[model samples]
Target: MKRLLLLGVLLAVSSTAHAIVIRHDVDDAKYRVPATEFPALVDMPGEGHGALIAPQWVLTAAHTLPMHGDLKQVVINGAARDVERVVVHPGYRTLPQTLIDQAMASGEAMLIVVFLASGDDVALIRLKAPVTDVAPVAIYSGTDEAGQIAKILGKGATGTGATGHSPSGPNRTELRRAFNTITSAYDRWLCYVFDEPPQALPLEGVLGNGDSGGPVLIERDGQWLLAGQGAWKVVQGNVLTARPGRYGQVTCNVRVNHYRDWIERIMAEPAQTTAVG
Candidate 1:
């Protein structure tokens, strides 16, 4: 069995952002997409990404928000939208620094996995005004997420699976789309492996730095549904030396269906005080 190390790719202001890493044989240009293609995909604070699930609500990962203050605004439809409020799931909690340090020092992979799985990694942003130009994506409520082919969109760092993520890649801000099949589904995570060559999709890839809070979408009845939120990457062996965004690594996204009720309840509320869990 392979030991897995769960690492968060959450972007911060001073850090560099990475997009999807593609197959070495494929053209990098093939992965690029127009910004108009994914209008619901918005830019979150700290260079993270989010999807608009409702006209007034944007769904994202809680960790992407600042630790000190409320996320005051987000870029939606290429325009800045004032945030009315932000609500992180009450069940969400960050692992203590002490425990994380211990896990890293002891090389205990399961300790990190169990702690991450136990927490809700989702959050919702309420916009002061409802967006009418771009249609919002619906949350996938079905239980059949495993084995589904998902389309991941991001505009961060870029590199090939053969080389992992490169810090010197050109213009790490182009919107790109890649495909991957969900290999496993837990109550809180959807895991997928990055395969090379014959086993990989024509444009197979995985998220890199700065893609946290991005959407993993599945098509249903000609409509795209939000199935997961980009959260963490699982690397095999010693995490300290592990090169992320490479073949054989796993990308685990926050399973969206598990918190559908929580999303609905928060959206239904007339107003919510800004809270971070």
Candidate 2:
């Protein structure tokens, strides 16, 4: 389970691998992303990816943005969008770089692990201009989605690697999609296990660096609902043993269902809706 332990340790790895698609045998083009779907790709100015949830609002992982201050500039799919407001989940907490450094200095992986699994990594970006052209995906607010198939989209690494091993090269720049079964669903998170090479599913993949803030979508009765956002990738053990080349990586997605009320409230507030950044 990627839960909290794996996410904490995986964050310590090099950002070059950002996110991954573990099976080298998979075709990258077949998973080509729709031009109008999953529209936010924070390739430059910022590092992670994102998705549009409203005409003028974008949703992503909080870590994708700077700790404090407005995002002066954000490029989504080549077009620059000024961020007016940033709303991070109050409970979202990741081990800061300074804390990570302290943990490394003291060899305290447990402390970092405990902090990373708080399960609140989501954030909302109010765009300066309305993105009315692209239709926003509806958020999922129904029952538990365990065992359901979901699509994970990103512009991450296409190469495969084990848990404790580092990627052999830089991550791919093209947008990609992979399918995974929701192994488990917690109150605030959804977990999906990425299969290793010799994949059981033709489209099975994992996450690396640039994949953060990407969308995890679920389809129901022909409607694709936004269920979660890419947060972290984890292996079973801690940094010392959870090598990338090792098999079994669990990808954690911040569950959208648990925060629907908060999202709705934020969207409805006009005062917090200005494009200031």
Candidate 3:
């Protein structure tokens, strides 16, 4: 199948992708964080990522899973855990790649917007056994995400705002964390922009290739809460001029608060007779 390249809809690929695109002036090492700092962050089937929200439940993007197959395992805290079942949101839907490509090629902004709004791109994975070593992260229930500083963690493609996503692709072994302020908050999405040098944060950055389903966190009191999950990017120009993770680019993540009830409902139910792939 052809990869869904537009809207930053990352699919599983064999090549290693890079992570966070930082400011041109900032040292790349500053964004490198230890695994212990985010133990709940787990590796999904491919380059995608998910967070442990409950002992045996993982929250991730619905698009990250295969359209027709079983998800056998997910790596949590460096260990593989058996996946008992996968539950995709009832509202979730997959658009044809040809339609997405045609819209981008024609610069049909309206079509792009309609396609993005068509589904709730969220999912949950129930593990066969609970992970005792890692502490699960909490979901942010508040609606005031705008103006808040968010810490984005991923092991995807890396580059600078001046140059956009690297031609070198991803560095899978290096996990990085970067900060960005939420520019806007919608009912289903939390948006952030990649600011230029003088206005950017110390380690300011945005998502690149392979970051789908990764976590976007906001601190409340002293604890970090999961506010969003990396889903797609809204570029300002046509397909020819578009550069993923470049300056002024906006990333729209799946708002966790909006789907809190759905997550709760899925986790509350007993094991399903069949898993949704």
Candidate 4:
């Protein structure tokens, strides 16, 4: 019996995948984001994605922002805050054309130039007035060791072939649950939710458009730590069921473990680059 229990735990650990399903590019929504939660999301000028991880810092995808409003302001929940800094990952290429090429080639290892969901993609921000209300998420960088269960939260869109802007609605980050196994874990890797129970998220319930730049958490014991950020999700055209539509990929939260130093270094730098090169 003891051996069986041990084996079960091992099996559980062995089967945990970490690929995130993130989406971008879409019109307005049919439904409304939660009221309590609505205050946390700030709208970027050019229309990318936004999520409040801490009272001060907003998390988001690097490539979403336009050069204009990089990281200028932050509206928490509803109240707006003036931007003080911008931080992009050092490794992220500033040019959009280059980023496009990289994405087309391997579909792995995205070097996002962090733009503060506002003026510039900010990895972290120092608020003008310290906000002690919402707790800041802890980021893990040293070990995304293969075979670890990772949890994620985001604001994915709804609606199927409802492809046009008219067919969707704003789905806020209510801390949804999606699990997968670690297929390959390197600088950047993939995870499969199929191996886990609840094979896939419902067609409309899965993380789609607004979910970009969210967190994929890794729960150890009773606590949760930030592991990956919502990146991409596969969508199918004229689809009835939820499937990884061809050319559609469930990509989110690039796992940041094994790079604790990078996070620390970025946090320590003058909010300059969004991605860590």
lDDT of each: 0.74, 0.63, 0.78, 0.39
Worst 10 residues of 2 by lDDT: 1-10
Instruction: Give the per-residue lDDT digits (tens) of candidate 4, residues 182-240.
Output: 44455543333323113332312233444545555667666666666544432222122
Clashing pairs in 3: 17-170, 18-156, 18-157, 18-170, 19-156, 19-157, 19-158
Name model 4 segments beyond 4 Å from true: 1-59, 94-122, 159-182, 189-206, 233-249, 269-277
| Cα RMSD, each candidate | 4.3, 4.3, 3.2, 12.2
lDDT of 1 by residue, 233-271 (tens): 765555444456778877888899988888888788767
Candidate 2 residue-wise lDDT, 60-179, digit = tens: 777777645667666765677777778877776655667566644554465454565664777788877887556777888766778888887776545554333343334446666777
Report, for all candidates in order, the number of backbone clashes: 4, 26, 7, 51
Please give the lDDT score at residue 49 for candidate 1: 84
Off by over 4 Å in 3: 1-3, 6-17, 104-110
**TM-score of every candidate relative to the true structure:** 0.88, 0.81, 0.91, 0.56
Pairs that collide, model 1: 18-156, 18-157, 19-156, 19-157
Q: Which TM-score value belongs to model 2?
A: 0.81
Candidate 2, residue 215: how far the Cα is off, in Å: 0.6
105, model 3: CA deviation in Å? 4.9
- Return the candidate ranking by lDDT, descending: 3, 1, 2, 4
Query: Whole-model lDDT for model 3 versus the true structure?
Result: 0.78
Better of 1 and 2 by lDDT: 1
Best by lDDT: 3
Give a tens-digit lDDT track for model 3, residues 1-277. 2123423432211111457778988888888888887999988766778899999999998767765678899999999999998898988877667765675567544555566666798899999999999999999989999999999998888788997774335435478999999999988888889999798887899877667788999999999999999887765656444556779878888899999988998899988757653
